[model samples]
Target: MSPTLTFALAGNPNSGKTTLFNSLTGARQHVGNYPGVTVEKREGRLRAAGRDLILVDLPGMYSLTAYCADERAARSFLVEEKPSCVIDVVDAGTLERGLYLTVQLLELGAPVVLALNMMDEVRRRGLSLDTGLLARLLGLPVVATVARLGQGTDDLVRQALEYAKARRGQWKPLELSYGPDVDRALGVMAARIEADRFLTDRFPARWLALKYLEADEDVIVLARGRGPTAAFLEETAARLARHIRETQATYPEAVISDYRYGFIAALLRRGVLQRTASPDRLAVSDTVDRVLTHAVAGPLIMLAVLFCMFQLTFLTSRYPMDWLEAGFGWLGEAAGAALPEGLLKSLVVSGVIAGVGGVLGFVPLICVMFFLLSCLEDLGYTARMAYMLDRVFRAFGLHGASVMPFIISGGIPGGCAVPGVMAARTLRSPKERLATILSAPFMACGAKIPVYLLLIAAFFPEHPGMVMFGITVASWAAALCVAKLWRATVIAGHSTPFLMELPPYRLPTLRGLLIHTGERAWQYIKKAGTIVLAISVVMWAAMTFPGLPPDRLADYDAERAALAAEREALPDDGSAQADRQALGERLDDLDNRQTEEALRRSLAGRLGVALESLSRLAGFDWRVNIALIGGLAAKEVVVSTLGTAYDLGQAEPEAPQALSGRLAADPRFTPAVALALIAFTILYAPCFVTVAVMARETNWKWAAFAVVANTALGFAVAVAVFQIARIW
Candidate 1:
């Protein structure tokens, strides 16, 4: 049987590698955690030349040295799998940085096709390349194309297949000098090493030996000569460190890195024109950053933009939201009237309509947020954010990119700290990554919306947008504080350089956008399908339990008539008309009291009361406490929880005691307390499902940390917001 052609596409981070992967594979790709870890494994197949090409788009990496999580993941695959062909996808515009990875791939001694992606950008910038010379110097076939537009991809794929079928081995990469002493040491080690057999015919054994010379973590895993190997590596690292210190020249890895850059500079100088101006990518980004990332005006603009988004979410969504609520309520009411007052009616009203309606109410919010975020991402402001804010983060020993995930997620209701931590995978250094991961929970996620909305309505009903702004800003503020705290205490490391890629600013793709919007919509729909259905029924049952004994009050009234004659006879004075109005009000008051009292006795209410201990520090009253407990099931349920707790019948409009009105009157929901609740909601633990996803996407340790840290942060921030607001 013919072997499957394995093709590896390697590139620098943010070179549109994943985008290219998605475009190529589409739905053919299957995503999963990489062997016992939350790091995702991306593999797909594309047929070319009547043979299956098993394509593995490796995680974007700065280098093959494995200093970061993504780098390590990529390196492991490259070394272990030894794929049939390696296609190094270099951003044509960012040629210099992208080519560095290309050089590293060639050193692996595999068949290589250099995919020069984004060629249109290069051409548009009035830049020209001698593709022939580049190929001749690199000793490989180089295909220039724009990956995003799907230009030249078919040809690139075909070339990859040709190389794979022929099993071509290209020219060796230019040697990188690690200083004379390092070379001498590598020579001596190579001769003494017995692990040479396994590495032979694969990557250069001498390169493996050279890595031991630099003590590169990526190469040591393939090492042999067991007992002595460990000791040798340790000793080598120590000796190298001493030499780097004594000579003041730096260690071998640093030396080699400089050499590689030097080599690249020389090659570019030979063929590429020297432009006095900056690359268009950077130029475009800098122009925009001047306005968007301005120190004095940026925050104001961000606030203004966010205000518009909030207005869009609430104002634009009202029509649809009302329609959804009314439609669902009518459906439930109709079904209740038609079906018997049993499981079937309950299922339609509570399990299906109520549950789905809750999610549906938030559809506009999700769509608006996702649309804005996608625009922010596409406009290249996200990259600029890194450049602007990373300097501040550096004081806390973290990268600017770490700020991207926080900033993007902070505004959105679904921004869970778990992915915030999972996003830490992009940070190259372990300490910085851990610090960023540890701090991400401070940013509020989407799931906190119900709590935010409920408390905001209860407290600051007039300034919902400002309340949202405060909540959003507060999460980031807390994140910065937490990052600083962790950096000062637990994490100690030198911050890595923040290398950001700013794509040419352009209008977002229409098809790509619809696809993105649809995916987000589907996320809401899918959540409804799973969590909402079950929780709605369960909540309905909780509120309905100990029901009013099927309204036997008529019989009770007949019995009461026999006993009311004496009281009525005494009440027939001139005050009867006023007394009747008073009685009417008293009857309304009694019904409300009865409904609330009965709700408290239900299974859900009892659970909320039990969970109140956890909310007491945050100043959540029993009702708020119950909402929080119910909220764990799904954040949208916080509204539904209020609807349930107030015993507003099966729907929001049916209940005579509007929770919103009650919140307006309640003293416990002061402005400060309301603001505090929003803060807590913004920073608190994600819903149960997000927590599970975080555990799956990252690790159980990270997942558990997200919950513990977020809950603590929420409590602390809420208290601080209340206490400070009271005085200020």
Candidate 2:
């Protein structure tokens, strides 16, 4: 049998590593988690030389130090799995920054190939690269191509296969100039330490010794045993760090990085035929960023952008949203005509039909929201948003990069939470990563959107758009506050300073953007049609009365016919007929009301009632409180619950409003109560899936604490808003 060759793809962020990966594996890739961490594990198999080439795409990172999650996760794989070959993807347009990581990978003793990608961009920027010289300098193969166009990927794979064929058991270690004193110290530490075989070559033994001196968590964990050897190495390392700190102006990493840059500068001077400056888009983007990142204008721009995006989400989606709702109503009517009034009939008309159909109606709105976000992300503008917010995040013990996972996860059930929490791995500190994981769910996720829209329609009828925007902002504000609180009491530390790479603004990749949008939209569709569909069916069944039999049918038919007749006879002022139609609809709604009242007496409604009653202690009524409780399992349930409740609530439909409209107008739904309900939903913990992810990502203990803290925080925030609003 042919031997299986393992290939690793490593690169800095925005270096086209992922694009190259897709070209290599097509749709054959599978995503999993690294055994104990939440970092995404991307693996795929490619056919080469009649043998399977297993390809692994490591997280985009600048280094392999185990300080943060991605670096640690990627470093672990490289050391343990020991891939047969490493393919280092680099940006041809920004070779210097990209090569920094490539140099580190080479230092690991892995057989490395440089895939200098984005060649088209390099040419457009008037840059000429001598691939041959670069290859010689790095002592490796170099392939130049545009990954997005699938140009050089085949060559890359071919070379990787060829390189693996001639692999040997031993490779040389990285040689560096840390000056005579530091070199001597490293040699002593390495000689004194005994550790895992994998560690011996993949990392500089001297480098490990240095971090051990500073008491790096990863180093200490890896060097747990070999008591005498470990202790001697650690004590000496600690002494070395103190001496360096007292004598030097910078830490070891900074010093080493400066040297690497200095070396690269000299190499560039020697290798280049001509050093020509090309006009680049970097100027335009930087000019724009200057204003957008201004302390004053930056926040204002963020708010304005958010407001406009939300405004577009609602306004643009309205037509399709209404069309979907009407389609569902028509389906319900069709079932009413075709089937007799029985269990099967009620289940079809109200339970299965109303439940499933109602949830599906929200798809258009969700797609619009996600579509906009996908575009923003694809254009690379989303990363800049994090940089703009860094100062604020740093104050809460988080770096700018920690925002991506949090922002992404706030969109749907089982959203980017795993990735977001894993994203915290980029931070150089464990405490910062854990803190990011703890506070990630406070952003109003897409799951909560349906509920917000429903309640806003039901409770703030005067301005639906404005209400939705307010709730979204509230979610963000609550997240900011919760993160700060977590930092102060739970995670307990300041975040390490960090830097973010800002990609030049380029036209978004249409294919990538559409695929991402579709993926997100598909998740929403599945949830609305399946998870919420089942929940809605259950709620519908509970809302149906004690008995749906012979006696009820006769009275139901009689009232329905009579109400229809009354609506027809109303004065022809148009609205009169509408009111009449509404009255007849109310007759149809009666059966749902019967079941709802019974459930209120039974197990489920009693639960909602109990929750509502508790909420009343915070100045909410039965209806607003019911939304609060029903929203626990799924925020969107608030809409379905209200719709069902209205189906069960007095059905006397008046004029042109939806069921939500009437609920809002009722005397019981005061502005304070409405605002309070919004506040609660915005700050409350996300549903089971999100909590489960948190538990799995940060451990159950922290996840459980997240739930408890949010529960209390939500109530406190809600009540405070209610009292304050009422007084005003």
Candidate 3:
């Protein structure tokens, strides 16, 4: 009958905090968004020592400065929610850098239990950490852990629970001395804060004073509304900042940082940590980085890795993809046979089955690609990719941080643009961030993957892998080029310097990879069954209604009857087989003409026809135009829409053909047209959700620009490709 205690999990990027959380919670966790924010939140439940516990995984942050959204979210949660205890996970091998955030958490007055992760890495590097002595020096319990293998997790949890129960939601702030002048200023600020009871219910007095000294924007804004006491604190902070700038040629924030690090150094010097070998010794990561990060070889190796990823994705997924296609085909055929010929039958077989089925057939390929990309990420090579590409990014007027947004937006061919656009918040430079947001959608995301796979299979089946690699390369090329143009024109600004910490390479765990891959693949499947299905049904209605006039249909019916009667009369004898075959071909031709005429008169077909004049410049006919229009809603809809359009037009409905096969056999579709369509799909506007996210992240004006500009660019590129390929 005890209440569930809440524990906040906090750590730096790549500190193995996530691994530890996964280890502790296993499959008992769920992910959601923080209140009123797009940043993701993870929460899990557990029972230990017969006490129910809730673990909240805060976003990975370097410090609680609240400069970026991630930091702000973490800081706000700690300040407002008042979690029972914070488990600060730190990289034991790099204790100095890792403990920076720990110090901030301590200053914030949160009850913290230090989980020193990566101890195995420390031992491998011939480093020694004295846990008991360190704990004593910091006056906090420290548990050494190897999170990936689930080592020390139980003990860490026990220590956290024991510490949380003892603290009982009470926070004791750690006050560090910032020399004489600043110490005097802090004394003035802290006393005024405590006396006036200024925001102390949520934050500790000294901690608020420290944030004021740091000029934390979130805190300052809150302080502004607290009346006269707020003015007094602001004046004191401003005076101290002016004095520090005059004397030290720096600001209070810098001084405060130095003192904090100085305090940590003093603590570590008391025999808390030691190195068995020289500090300059090259570790495994550095040794490997010599080759992996080499200027000349790195880019080449990255391309080879990407090529292999695509090759493996296509090769390994072929059998499963084939099986899915066959299953869907049979289902569609069965539905067609069971239902009478009418709107309901078409809706079930062509609209729902064919449309959604086309997208679901590529699920195995998406899963394989996602799994491989997750492997690269967990192994820490993705960071190196960003590091290596930083130079190229800068040349194109993008910050090094932009590489991640691009990667997440489908730079690897399976990422979603919504999160990718949100990821642009990490960029400090506004111009670079906006450019990244606009250009990221150029990557071949999972939605676009089906479109690519369909076209590549239809026209370039001999080397689908190589063709896919080419498409990926082309996507990157387009993004970089557009970014450069933006930088040189409307969004012109000086590119900020890029600084990133490359985590040491580690073997990815199978469990972690599977979980990550499964989550992403499930999302794709769910979208196919939900969004794609609904849109497909709507498209089917649009393509089916206002049927060819009753008289027109009667003419086709009479021709079909006459042909059938002739076939019935002649098919009895083996010598008359040729005559019967000619009659059947004539009936099929009449049916196809009727079907095409009906489609041309339908609503969606009319809109497509209206756009065909311009679309044909890029080698797209009315049918392709309809699919492309549907792509505005979602890139995957392009595939599903095509499936529906082709199914409705197919003369031989008894034997349903795969979309790829149908496209390949269509007279209007050729290698040149397929290439143009692929190019267009890659460069067109992102899905509706991505556009909404972009609008939320920036504004509707920019989001509108992304749509208009990208579509225009896509069309222009498609036209050039189609024209040039035709000549060739």
Leading candidate by lDDT = 3
- What TM value does model 2 have? 0.86
* Model 2 lDDT-worst window of ten: 648-657
Model 2 local distance difference test score: 0.70
* Per-model CA lDDT versus the true structure: 0.67, 0.70, 0.91
| 306-406 per-residue lDDT for model 2 (tens digits) | 67777788788889988877777777777767887566766676555555554567788778788778777777677777887788788766777777766
Best-to-worst lDDT order: 3, 2, 1
Superior by lDDT: candidate 1 or candidate 2:
2
Q: List candidate 3 segments past 4 Å from native.
A: 26-32, 195-197, 225-247, 276-281, 330-345, 429-431, 487-492, 562-580, 654-656, 699-701
TM-score-based ranking, best first? 3, 2, 1
lDDT of 1 at 290: 79
The worst-scoring run of ten residues by lDDT in candidate 1 lies at 649-658
Cα error, candidate 2, residue 511 (Å): 2.7
What is the TM-score (0 to 1) of candidate 1? Answer: 0.85
Q: TM-scores for all candidates?
A: 0.85, 0.86, 0.92
Q: Candidate 1 at residue 203, lDDT?
A: 50
lDDT of 3 by residue, 699-720 (tens): 9999999999999999999999
Q: Each model's number of backbone clashes?
A: 5, 10, 0
